[model samples]
Target: MTEPQVRRVRLEEGFEVQAYIYGEGDETLFLANGGPGLPSLYLREPHARLARDGWRVVAWDQLGCGASDRPQDPALWALERYVAEAEQVRAALDLGPVHLLGHSWGTWLFTEYCLTHPEQVKSCILADGACDIPHLVGELDRLRSALGAETLAMMRRHEAEGSIDHPEYQAAITILNYRHVCRLQAWPDSLTAALADWNMGPYGEMQGPNEFTYTGNMKDWNRIPAMGAIAAPCLVLCGAHDELTPACSEKMHAALPNSWLKIFEASSHMPFHEEPEAYFPAVRAFLEEVAARAAVGGLTRKSHPCR
Candidate 1:
């Protein structure tokens, strides 16, 4: 696959967001990455394949992460800003009617964007999806608790002492992260770089200090009630061992009238990294079906809400 070209796409907000563009296919997939603050490069595992397999893909850092601008203003880290940022990126690039895809926290932004701007979407993909922030945090809490008493105690002690950066705390988090985040024997360098480059400005203010906590502004964010507003055919992707959980993806599938669900049984949150054998094939098939549907005409999204 060709290397991603680092490009600048100017948003409506009059600021340019850094992005990586790959492939030259007619069908463009706009990626909304996870971590309200994570660099978008981790997406290369799944997306680079899409580009090589004949699809145009655009993955970018949202304002404050990766190669993107880092203004350090907390006021710019709200949920709405990211949603608007996605819209601006699409518009500035003139990437007409893309197959919008989001992973983890990115799913929340994708959902809200589709609801508000249904006209710009050809299809939607939610990978390792989460619908309610409270539910997400609760699930995270359970995952942390299941990590055994000693590890949990170490993590909690560090949190209580405000020593989240303590080596003990970091070590404990790695144990938990290895279980639910990647499950790979060794993490890919891209994912490693993403963690190293994670912008605390956006993460701490929006997603919290770490994955198991949620003291940020998104604690009450819930988009289930607004699922009907998306009005676009969707693909819900999740791992059986996912921290986001299959239930989260199922909730979206049930609510979305024209939606399908795929679960990678052997993987967790980062299925692309953990279960590429299943993850990539499933995604390719879904996109193929989407392409076939588009060739015939367009997806007729359901007009009613889930009851």
Candidate 2:
């Protein structure tokens, strides 16, 4: 694989976000990553195959995380701001009608962006994402219970006291992450590198300390009811054992009129790494199907057919 072309995109005067462009293609895949804060490093390999197939995958570390400029204001971490950052990146690069893909919290960013800028996206892929946070929290309760009564108590105690760094707390959450987040015995080097460079600013303020404990500003976030607003062809992807879970993906699939769901049976959150055999083929087929329909003139909203 060739080194990505790094470009600085201006969000506003004195503020520029770092974006990495990988591969060359006629179709553009603009990726919005999760973490609400994670850098784009963990994403390098997942989309490389897409690039090889003539899909230019563009991913960026949004402001306040990774290699992007960190802003001190908490107000800067809102969903609206992230949407705007994506728009700015699109404008700076002049990437028209991209096939947008988002993973985890990035899917939320994709949802809102596609809702507001329907004309900008040709199609969308939401991987391991939920349109309902409340439903997700309820699922977390079930998952935490599976961790045994003792571990649940320890996690709750640490969260209440704000001692998120406590060893016991870390231990419990690590179990949660290991079982659901990735489920790989060995972490990929790119994933480790991205994790090492994490900035807690945006995450703590938006998604809270960890995956299970989402006490941040987005706690009440739920878009399932309003998913009808989305106009693009959407492919909803989720793992059978993902923290985001298959049920969450089901909600979005049911709500989006022109959408379908594909499950990675033996995988968790990061299916690209966990089940690349099934992962890439499913995604490639979906994108190709959408592109093919588009080449013949896009679908009409009156019919709004599901794929």
Expressed as tens digits, the lDDT of each residue in 134-234 for candidate 1 is 77777887788887888888888888888899988887777777777888898889899998988888888877787777888988888887797776678
lDDT values for all models: 0.83, 0.86
- TM-scores, all candidates, are 0.91, 0.95
Q: Which residue pairs come into collision in candidate 1? A: none
Whole-model alpha-carbon lDDT for candidate 1: 0.83
The local distance difference test score of model 2 is 0.86
Q: What is the lDDT of residue 258 in candidate 2?
A: 80
lDDT by residue (1-307, candidate 2, tens digit) is 5688999888863677899898878889999888877897787557866788888989898898877888788889899888988998998998888999999989999999998899998999999998788899998888899999988888888888889899988888898899999899998888888888888889999988889978889989998888898878888999999999899999999999888789999899999889999988888877887777786776443433334
In model 2, what are the clashing residue pairs, if there are any?
none
- For each candidate, how many residue pairs have backbone atoms clashing (under 3 Å)? 0, 0
Best by lDDT: 2
- The CA lDDT at 162 in model 2 is 82
